[model samples]
Target: MQRLVLRRKEFSLFQAFIYKNIGISLGDHKIYLVQARLAKRVKQLGLESFGEYYDFLVADRKGGELEYLSSLISTNVTSFFREHKQWEFLKSHLASILERSGGRLRIWSAACSSGEEPYSIAMFLAEHLPNMTQYDIKILATDVSPKVLKIAMSGMYSQKACMSLSDEYLRKYFSPVLVENEAYYQISDMLKKQIIFREFNLVTGDYDLFAQKAFDIIFCRNVMIYFDRPTQNKLVDRFHAILAKEGHLFIGSSEALTDMKKEFKSKSASIYQKA
Candidate 1:
């Protein structure tokens, strides 16, 4: 079978389609990258051309194919404790946030790929907060990819995946388990109970679903970089609306809220506090 080639016109069509639907801004230089990422999918679908794949994506009503396209195009590079500085800030200010909420806390790990970010939060809370069971704490971990969510829900990681974790954290929070004749570290049920993982697309997901929810800390790290200024501003506004007064927003170290006008004041590196 001949490999599908992404023609220039097909690239243009994809650039517009991805921008309109996924909110990712693709530059002229990204043509090769997009082709490289999408070639496999186009071939897997047995489509002769990228244009046919594009047509198939548009005609599919359930939107799963579009999601797969988004998954292929978007990056999901993540790990435990990705931003050290942000975690440090969270640790220092956690006492105040807890006091404000009177031991009740709500945290949302937006774009929590493969469960690392949310699980890291749970571990940090367990390690630092005394009488860990005393507080009414819940973490809402959401992602756009069902593929990553499945790995996250399972909480199983190989020794390679667990390498970055500290010995103390691994011993305290995870248990050794056998999976398919190999050893894997599994997150403890105690930690798992604190998190609720769900599938959510930040671009197209409805805000009305969270009408009654107010988050004290929202971690939307590393995702806005893919979006244009307009999309970024819109998302920041939505986050602000759902955040309680004096709540915090944690973005990726490389991303900034400077271009987007918002009420959040910069507290530290990539950390913002609602004022």
Candidate 2:
């Protein structure tokens, strides 16, 4: 089998396709990256060139190939309790937030990769919220990749994935099991019961679905960094529209709102409150 080189023309086509469909902006330098990431998959599909792969992605009406492309182009490196500062901020403000909502707390873990972020929210609330049974708390965890969502729904993690977790949290929230001589931890039903996972494409998804739903906290961390400025601004606007008054928006530490910061007051580093 011959190695397929992704031509400049083919790269440009993909660049436009990804931006229009997925809201990610691929720079000129990323051509090599696209080739490196997708060439093997193209070969495995028995496609002769990157162009054919792109066509296959478009022609497949079910959008499964597009999902595969999304999984490849985006990085899903996540773990339990990522971005510690945001959690600390939530802890300090939890009481007031719950009070404002009258004990009905809704959190949206947008781009919840591999279930960790939403699960972390559940665990954090379970640990912090006093009289947790009295509160109607639910978390909606969404991501574009069904692959990761499947992992998330299972609520199982390998021993290596649970390294960052503390001893007490592990004992309280997870049950240990051996699968094929490998150690894994399953999330407790208490935590799983609080979350609902679904597939959503942030860029192309219908915002109308959330017209009636206003989230208290929207954790869209680390996702905006991949989008262009215009796409980022539009997404911020959509988030602003659906968030409750004075709701919080948590972004990745590496990302900033820039022009969109006017609509949201900065509470902490990469954390904003809807003004």
TM-score of each: 0.96, 0.97
lDDT of each: 0.89, 0.92
Model 1, 9-125: lDDT tens digits are 999999999888777899889988998999888888888888898899889999898878877887888899889998888888889999998888999999988899999999999
For candidate 1, the 10 contiguous residues with the lowest summed lDDT are: 255-264
Q: In model 2, which regions exceed 4 Å deviation?
A: none
Winning model by TM-score: 2
Angstrom error at residue 235, model 2: 0.4
What's the lDDT for residue 180 in model 1? 89
Which stretch of 10 consecutive residues in model 2 shows the poorest summed lDDT? Answer: 255-264
Backbone N/Cα/C clashes per model: 0, 0
Question: What is the alpha-carbon lDDT for the whole of candidate 1?
Answer: 0.89
